[model samples]
Target: MALGVWSPSLIDVVLFVIAAVVVWKLERRRRRGWATGRLPPGSEGLPVVGETLQLIAAYKSENPEPFIDERVRRHGRLFTTHVFGERTVFSADPEFNRMVLGAEDRTVEGSYPSSLSTLLGTHSLVVMKGARHKRMHSLTLARLTSPTAIREAKLLLHIDRLVRRTLDSWASSSLVLLLDEAKKITFELTVKQLVSYDQRKWIESLRREYLLLINGFFSIPFPSFLSFTTYGRALKARRKVEEALKEVIRKRKLEKATTRFDVDVNESQNNKKKKDMLEELLEGEAEGMTDEAVVDFLLSLLVAGYETTSTIMTLAVKFLTDHPRALAQLREEQEGIRKKKKDEEAALDWDEYKSMPFTQCVINETLRVVNIIGGVFRRAKTELHFKGYTIPMGCKVFLSFRAVHLDNEYFDDARTFDPWRWQKNAAAQQVGGPTVYTPFGGGSRLCPGYELARVVISVFLHYLVTRFNWEEAEKDRLVFFPTTRTLKSYPINVRRREEEEGA
Candidate 1:
């Protein structure tokens, strides 16, 4: 090495050291400002990136527990880690999480990553707060869950057709990736149910763009340069989806007006007039809701309606395949229901869906095991104290349901896949209090689509277990970060029931 010349490696080491020093100083200054109260113990990590890389790495790993486990060992159940560019108090303590969840909008309110708010839109339901949030939530729920809105025979037929077509598509293939296929089913279902839009026409391009938009939700808050960076691509994808949805909204409005003039209200009401979420929103718009709110509502519903439900449905297959006894029980339950039905092709009605107690147990078990929604994010509305630690006003808090659901204290033998645990008098069934094992979240901010998601999963599972049998082609390489999913999309070999019986 030359004595007077600096090598590239030397320059890199020098920069790293300088960066470390700067980060340490900034963290210390920030801590000093919060020294008035006892804050939760944990690291904020390096400057800019903070603990995000570590958090993301854990999520990508097959075993994500170590990330929270190691932290809990160091800082107890209630600790702090900076994730998604915010200093967050991550609570694995079930009691504390419940308090925070119940205190929504009092001491804390919903907060999400900047990328999510940006991609979802400024008026997204997930980010909306106060009176506006309440109004949107009420209207959205009424439209989604109303008795009249839910009984649309056309919508049920569409779901049946889509599910069957998806299964048929996979029948010829030797290997099927559940996540990929599940996404197809969910995306199409949400599109039809929410907007009455036939996705087959634009599904390929739209799915690609939608994925780009999703990736942006996890990307670093980097400035988009020439629409080339991850963030830039996300922004572009959002614009494309927004435009497409806007066009659909416009067309629907015109159609609604045309229909209004074509038929009398009494005549139309007398008929089985099918109404989707868009139609309900159009009605609301006529009552004075803004177009922007309608678009945001549609976009938010696409995510809420599809992503988590699809993830859970895919995981149900994985878990069922791994546990044959449970699979057999589920098959028996589903088969019994099928045999009792006069029409084999008839879709599961709301009452029929409600009758499947064992199936609901399976769904609950899958939700607990998969923990698709890692936690809920809320910002402290005022200075708050929990377990003798202070969370200064505006500090971000993440209620870690994953930790709680998996904790042995809350769920005996929690790591195992045991749907039977949800059965009456089962140990696991007795363990949950009001908020323990809250996979759907809790309080006012709990997912309003919870019931709808449950029904969707149940319907898919009913058709799946009765119509087909699946075996994993390879061991699942499950990823837990950002969300719980498969590294390779969880490929499996599926066979139709008739083919399997013949073989």
Candidate 2:
């Protein structure tokens, strides 16, 4: 038939459709090849979904390393895969991970999954960029690390009192869920440090909402208006938390204003207490930051200071329990400190807190082995060349701290819980460089509360070893998906040291 004025046969129509499909596929492949240039070697798995399902499944299991280990065997340390709805390169190489973290805002920028970005809010530090990130990060770091903050006498006393009170409550109970209890201790401390609000009922209510918000971070992001999904529930919980925080901010502002005109004697005495982070943010250190921004920032800090730090503390206890020799050594060190104090009931001073060397080893080992924060996500801003391979612009990169931390090449029996390994000078460098052991992340994005975490954990350990004895009440296993945590919240049977001595 003449193409300009003829009817086509069914076979001819079929042939034409086939040809078009072929052309379209070829064009798509050609565009992808050109856009990505030379990517690392790995599979993109199923279309659209990619290997995300596989990643999630592996994470859900007790061991998540197989996902990366299998890939590393086939594709070496650096490989490519599609996950979280984007083509990404997974880097287990220490040098590459270091470069990626250090290159923030230059060649790459901090990124997270759509769910995380939405739940954490647009103004959260993890989603900030350029000068705004630098300013907020610097301000947060300074305030948290300052002598007037963690190291202050009042704050140190507060932390010690809080830790002691928490442990005291546990003395009456024979069985305790360590992870849940640890969360309570850290949550109250964080709330106190942030807003100076420690009403037990209010904090318990806020924490319930916070947990819902956190669970949504790793969920499939469906439109909240469309369905009642985990992410949707998370969005709702976030609103409740934000409203609670905003009310706190409003009262704080009103108090600040009222104090200027009329001050009762008790009010003046109360005002003499040291300023919290919220007070600093409200009084102009974070000038021009909106109420929403302030709330988001505090929300992020709560995640950092509360969830992660509590997990670390719980795991540290777990690790030490699994290795009694380490626990004994740690107890001896802490006891030595206790002997020097004039009053055994007195709070630990800054020097005493800093003096626990072996305790630091336990914390480091826990961080390395458990890797509560398995990895971080960043987006490439420009073509990034590393080790003769080109990372195309706009590609998501995952710096697998878990892979690096668990790799035998980096540490001797890297997966083992050996606190003694950190005994050498330049402990992190004993096996590899500092980049290889980034439990709290690294570079400019390093956790601002790192010191505070160490201090809090150290304080808890001192009281725990010196005051009480505990044993696992039941067997529990670790789960790595969404986040790393114990299956049973690490239940333990406790006995106060005094009762044991009296018996």
Candidate 3:
């Protein structure tokens, strides 16, 4: 309390030094706490790098989550690891998932479909937040939902015709690869239903671009190395889509711009009717973007909407083959539907689809187990405080549930695939719920097409099971193919029933 000239006792100087040290340590803790945790419970790892290398190594063959399992079991649910000069959380906890997704996610900075952002503009749907997300999703639902009546009619006939065509050809080879066949069928149908009026060749070109753009995401971001495969290919494919979309958009603009009818020009329903999502997005402010931006959105949707579904289908079959009893049960259920009269031919109306408890369990179980991608991501939006720890904003957050679902606490015999664990009245397993079971992710901003995926997947499975008989060729040998290049895919073989019956 004395003036500047006054001297302090030796004890006062010692107290000042201790106070300074304490303050420094507290600041350091705040900085450290803001980053996401990389190490999940149980496992041994050195600082900074943790188990990243092990994860990539696991992707080389069967059972990638084991390393993750080792860590989670040893460490417990929450632990830390540093990577690329940052800390991250890799969680499988339902509560943690709920915090990230369902809780308005203001803790997270932003999310995107990731792979789509590099190919499309950053402002595209994958990168949108708040108002933009709501608007775009609404518009997209309108477009996708508009033709539901038409799509439903298309589904029954399209499914039957597709199965028969594929099965009819199955005799050439006793074994059929359901993986490839299902993708092609879905791709063709997705294009037909979604593209609606585009010319076949043009739609094909767009589809090709979508696949290319997707690959760009997983690449090392090394432009010099992959200019030809990733960078150059994305640009060329993007240009093709831009050309086709721009032409249509321009024609529509001219038609709308001029009141007088051009007698020679044939008009599209899209032009006469109110704008579809694509058209609406093209016209909407969408942050003052241009025609190329709109094309990017369409291409991205096809990639996420189509490709993810295809991956799920592949995993579903692989799971079904692994558990024959479950597979048999599914087919038996389908057989009952197959016996229905033509007028009552078992179709899943919205109610029936939602009511399929067993099928819902199958989907959740599949999502819980499938390692379609190695990571889930979000960036911190603001400095968030949890458990007396502060995480600085703009840091990335990830939950690699590969190990969590297999965590014994979450599942009793976690390695085994069991849909019954989720069934009502079961003794009880730790449910991952929406967050930890998040293949579609959590939050209001969760993937809009998830419901659409369930419908498409359920219908596809129903058709495949009831109408065709098939078996795995190298059931055990096949594994999910991992490329440093892109999304996970698998190859499996099957035998067609119709041909066996004919024999």
**Model 1, TM vs. native:** 0.88
lDDT of 1 by residue, 313-397 (tens): 8888888888999999989998998998999877667677778988888888888888878788899999988878999987889
TM-scores of all predicted structures = 0.88, 0.90, 0.74
Whole-model lDDT, model 1: 0.79
Best by lDDT: 2
What C-alpha lDDT values do all the predictions have?
Answer: 0.79, 0.85, 0.57
Cα TM-score of candidate 3: 0.74
Over 4 Å off, model 1 = 1-30, 146-149, 152-158, 260-274, 285-290, 425-433
Query: Least accurate stretch of 10 residues (summed lDDT) in model 1?
Result: 424-433
Residue 281, candidate 2: C-alpha displacement in angstroms = 1.3
- What does candidate 2's lDDT look like per residue over 1-503, in tens digits? 37645554565578767865776566457447646477888998876567999999998887878999999999999999978767789989989998888888999998888889888888887888899888888877777655556665377888899999999898678999999999999999989888999899999999999999999988977668734788889999999999999999989889878975565555565556447789878776557878888999899888888888888899899888989999999999999999999999989999998899899889888888888778889988998898779987778899998898899988889889998888973443432235478887887888777778888899999999999899999988887878764454999999988889999
Clashing pairs in 2: none
